[model samples]
Target: MMRRLLTLPLIGCLGACSLTPALQRPPAPVPASFPVASAVPASAPASAVPASALGWRAMFGDPRLQRLIDLALENNRDLRLATLNVQAARARSNIEGAASLPTVGLDATHSRERTLATDATSRELDRQTGVNVALSAFELDLFGRVRTLSEAAFARYLASEQGRDAAQIALVGAVADAYFTQRLADEQLRLSERTLTDWRQSLELARLLKQAEQNSSLDVAQAEGQVALAEADVEGRRRALAEADNALQLLVGSELPGDLPPAVSLERQPVIARLPAGLPADLLLTRPDLRQAEQMLVAANADVGAARAAFFPQISLTASFGYASASLGSLFDPAREVWRFAPQISQPLFQGGRLRAELRLAEVRKSEAVAQYERAIQVAFREVADALAGTATFDRQIEAQRRAVSATQRSLELSELRYRAGLDGRLDLLDAQRQLYASRQALLDLRRAEIANRVALYKALGGGLHADSDDAAAAPTESRG
Candidate 1:
């Protein structure tokens, strides 16, 4: 009897209809294509591989940076946490998935009871033993409530997976940016120290001229001031370099490996792979955060379905087959056979408007999710556009700054020669030296910005999610676990 009863529900499950509303993806809220107002460089030819397809190894090119990114991926606390969250979400989804199925258990029980002796009654005792297989309260999901909740959980799981990918992308960019900053500081410190040495030599020359009455004490004092300024800059650069190192170490999540490939200079770092800004729709497939937001929207939509299903009847079943006897030896005897089949149905008649309120809440949440999804798309669009503009503009800005540095270097040389020949005053020589130093610093800063811009563009376009462009397209969208 119990077997027949369970079979009926299984057949019902096969034909049960879902109450979930048909899902319609909200329209993209951005322009069809990225703006072309100086966002892309004319010289930059579109790469065969899109940014999403270009992996970190090929884009970074620097072996040292590549190693650091690998270490960060393995050990970074934030990434570790994101990965754990994905696992947790997967477990929750599995739990919900199991809810739509029956849970069965084997049961064994033995009980003994005795009536205490009394003046008018003789002592008596009873013992019973039994074994059975039981089915617990398993929902039939006739209205798809359990199934919709399971769907919601599965969507949330996918969202968490995407979130992990996003974290990884951001981590790679952070490590690269920190590495460039540290290298820039090193370069700046070197320049400051070398300038200090030159100014110290000039101060000696000024003292000699002063002793010979060829120049005033003011010349010596000015040279001393220049040397002091360079010394101060050197110290500041040293502190900045230390802090940058600390930041990089934190990102890597451990002390940098001693065997890390040789460091590349800021100027020598490879150009990040050029990215073609495809249509805004491509972001849906490429950007993990966008995917994550869409998944959340999916979960929210599923929640609405579940809320709707709740207004219908809920059916569940509890069935068991077993044996019962007074003696353990006879527990499984044919004569002791017993079976039970219990089916239940519930309908919400009146809840003081609670059910209606819940349905309204679910609908409102779904609406909110749509807005959030669209807003995420808008934000991602802005990020990609800004990165494109940076890539286009930084090159021209870097080239112009290089020219200024070159001109300032020549001016400093001439001013030094004129001052030594007594044709120009100490003030003119000092001014030229100051201009040269500032120009060089500006050039260094701009170079760092250009490299960092490339990193930003790579990150913004959803690069660094895979190690090879060839593998990115094949990356798994669904959790195998």
Candidate 2:
């Protein structure tokens, strides 16, 4: 009988019927195609590889940024917690799956008894020893109750894995964004320091003119005011730079190392300038959060099946095979061979409508899962659309701002030459200087925004998971769930 339990044919007969309803994926609650946004041009060519397939290293060329991302993926506390959750879910799924199988064990027993003899008032002693292979109470799963619960647990495990992936993607984007912010702060600080130096020189020249009786005290005073403003700006920029550094360090999960690669300027940051936004429906496949939500729905659907199976009879088996004898030497003797088989069935007769309530609860939870899945899809669609809309517009804005910076610089040069040659008062030169500084600052901010938008679009499209495009094709399928 123990040998028979290991036979493939008998094992295959478990959970023969599944009460789970067929799963039908809900239609996406958004447009088939994404709306055309001003950020992305109509004529722009889509990349040969979608952003989802492109690795973060390929998208962001800066070595320093790549290193930061690597550190975050390895050391970030949130991502580590997410990974642990996946492992725990996998263990739970294994436990649920094991429910459909028998729990076989080895048992041994030794006992001594003392009783009165039947023929006389004398006592007798007896000893018995036995060894057996036993099967504990194991559900037969004839109605698929255990199997459906196992399926639900497995689905939840898959959902947790996807959640881990989502966490990693978010971590990558955050590291990149913080790095860009730090670089922006660095640029602004430098600009402010340079402006302060130029303003101080102008004040010196104004003072000289005042002493020579060539300019009024008002000129010197105005120059002093401009110098004061520039000094304040320099201090403000320093504070911003320090804050940016702190933010970047937090995202990197540790203090930055001194051996990092040279920082790149905002204008020359190596991030990909444009990312292709595919059709909205593609989000269902690319985004991990969407996949996680779908897996949750699958788990809920399986729960309903398990609940329905509760209305049927549950069968279990318990048995033992071995020998029992009064002497230990005869424990394995053929004459002492003994076997026991017990099969039991439980059919719920009355439980005050508890089973019905449970079934109803499962059904309602399934409905909620459906709503949640659809909402996730809708939110994903909106994010991708917003990122696409900003793509081309950021490019145009940066270009226009660059030209403004150039125009102001030229105007400043003219005003400076005129002031030195006594052709114009110090007021015009100071105004030109102020305009040039403002324009340059605006240009730096626009550059940072453009870079930040690119990062957002990449994240929105579900990029940053794979380090190689080839791995995208090898990603796991949903058949296991």
Q: Pick the candidate with the highest TM-score.
A: 1
lDDT scores in order:
0.87, 0.87
Estimated TM-score for each candidate? 0.92, 0.89
- Candidate 1 segments whose C-alpha is farther than 4 A from its true place: 1-15, 37-46, 116-122, 473-481
lDDT of 2 by residue, 1-481 (tens): 8688786566576556579998888889999998877655544334568888888888888889988988888788999999999999999999999987899999899999999999888999999999999998988787789989999999999999989999988999999999999999999999999889988988898899889998999999999999999999999999999999998888888888899988878777777766778798887788898999999999999999999999999878999999899999878999999999999999999999999999999999999999999999998888887777778587777778889989998999999899889899888989999999999999999888878888888888999898767786577644423
Error of 2 at 172 (Å): 1.3
Window of ten residues with lowest summed lDDT in model 1: 37-46
- Model 2, runs deviating above 4 Å: 1-15, 38-46, 112-126, 418-425, 473-481
Candidate 1 lDDT tens digits, 1-481: 9999999877687547777787787889998998784654556434678888887888888888888889999889999999999999999999999998899999999999987677647877889998999998888777788989999999999999999999999999999999999889999999999888888998999999899999999999999988888888999999999999999999999998789888888777775536777888888888899889889988998999899988988878999999999999988899999999999999999999998899899999999988999999999899888877787788788889989999998999999899879899999999999999999999899999878878887887888899887798787654222
lDDT, residue 141, model 2: 82
